[model samples]
Target: MLELTNVSSGYGETQVLYDLSVTAKAGRVLAVLGRNGAGKSTTLKTVMGLLPTRSGAISFDGATLPGKPYEVAKAGIGYVPETRDIFPSLTVRENLDLAAKRFEGSDWTIERVVELFPRLGERMSNGGTQLSGGEQQMLAIARALLMNPRLLILDEPTEGLAPVIVQQIHDKLMELKRGGLSMVLVEQNFGFATSLADDVAIVSKGQIVWTGSPAEIRADIEAQHRWLGV
Candidate 1:
């Protein structure tokens, strides 16, 4: 559903990506694994058009994506950053209402998202800041789903949450996968990322050092240590 060919990007004067090519197919999760400062988040930002690619192509569903975030979103890719970004003053319902992007034939509705995440339904009237951190993360995911995106790109979805909440997010992601939603997950929790991913890519120094299946990553201890420093 998404493809990047030799895409290179960076902040002003400091490069963070180098010929990074990756693909996340429809109905599958592609986990990008790396240690701190390994450019995993940079790759996602480039794909989301938060950072412009210096060279190469990014395409979604066979069409070239313009290097603008709104254009990217209009093409059906949803991004949730490491920060649980939401309108702090808005109620849960109001936040969801603001993210509506219904194209003809889209299937994910706000009601369906609330059904998937019942906690969100329960807190419909609560202000964003009033919810717990985990609840806010849930709200972020729910808000993204409300866009009815074809591919969901998440950056460090389980970075700083309690284990129980991580498990909750994991279970919800699995359900979304079963329902045939494509996802690109940039994750730090190795076990959680591998367990849910069909394909794995290890990034280091702004480049992909390894690409394989989850089982292969688990089996090759040497590659694990070399690229991931784990």
Candidate 2:
């Protein structure tokens, strides 16, 4: 459903991605795994048009993606950054309100997302800053769902959270996957990622070094040590 071919992008003269290529197929989850500074997040940013595609192409659902982030979102792609970029001053409901978009046949709604995330339902009136790390992460994902995206790109959904909270996030993502939501996940939690991903792409130095089924990646200890340092 989403393809980035030979894409290169960076911030002002310091190139981070080099001829990188990856694909997230329809109704499947693609996990991009890499160590820090390996340009994993850069790949997502380029695809989302947050960073200019310095070279190569990105296509979504058979069409070239627009050159703006908002356009990309409107094109049915949702991004939940690792930073959990919620408006600290806004109430939980207010944050979700900003991202709500409705169209014919849309499956996601504020009421539905709140159902998926019961914690969010209880904290609708709480300010963004008042939530815990896990709650903030839940709020971020809930807000993205409010957009009714066809493809969701999540950067480190489990980062900096307690193990129990990580499990909650993983369970919720599994529900989304079962619902046929195409996703591109960049995460450091290997077990959590591999459990949910159908395909895995290991990135090194800004380029994809290996692509395989999650089962293949899990059993290849040498590849894990060499590419992922696992």
Candidate 3:
């Protein structure tokens, strides 16, 4: 479980998030939905300590989050930035090997990840730059899972991919959900996100404007238009 309460953060002298708050419950998906520049990605960055938490608090699993990115990752939080920051020069196996971490009772393994992403298995020797957009996204997710995170934070997992690839990503995420992974997702693909998310938080101008079930958000056309521009 993760909670960000009244958190406000931003770039130097240009605040983006304003008293923002959201929660990701245990073994459930929380989708943060917003238009561009709504500060959705900023929320995740602040939580990861990539950006300083200018004000307010972020707690994970009942403890205050560490103030450094690596420490946060060690604390059982995995982040997949929207950029899918993979090492372009490294082979697929090399990239995954660098992120591999194991602990007592850890269920994620390279074998399991490859099973989840068969494409990645076949492309084990391929360089990061040689992969397609969807393959890169799969690699990113696979790398994160290798860290054995208790809570996975993904930013825009379905962005810039073909519809069929999106569906593949969606199906893989569903499998992860069924395996009881707690996830916080920020995504532009509404239908893909809503299908997987247990709850929805709509961000507007760097703050959460609404929180509801996916079904509730789907039916509220006015909220969709007003807050999400859907």
TM-scores for candidates 1 onward, in order: 0.96, 0.97, 0.97
The TM-score between candidate 3 and the true structure equals 0.97
Extract clashing residue pairs from model 2.
none
**How well is each residue in 1-230 modelled by candidate 2, as lDDT tens digits?**
89899999999999999999888999999999988999999898888888999999999999999989889988999999999999999999998887774433467888889999999989999999999999999999988888889999999999999999999999999999999999999999999999999999999999999999999999999899998889
Query: Candidate 2 versus the native: TM-score?
Result: 0.97
Two-way lDDT contest, 1 vs 2, winner? 2
RMSD of each: 1.4, 1.2, 1.3
- Count of steric clashes across candidates, in order: 0, 0, 0
Per-residue lDDT for 153-182 in model 1, tens only? 999988788999999999999999998989
Better of 1 and 2 by TM-score: 2
Order of the predicted models by lDDT, top scorer first: 3, 2, 1
lDDT, each prediction: 0.89, 0.92, 0.94
Candidate 3 wrong stretches, greater than 4 Å = 101-105
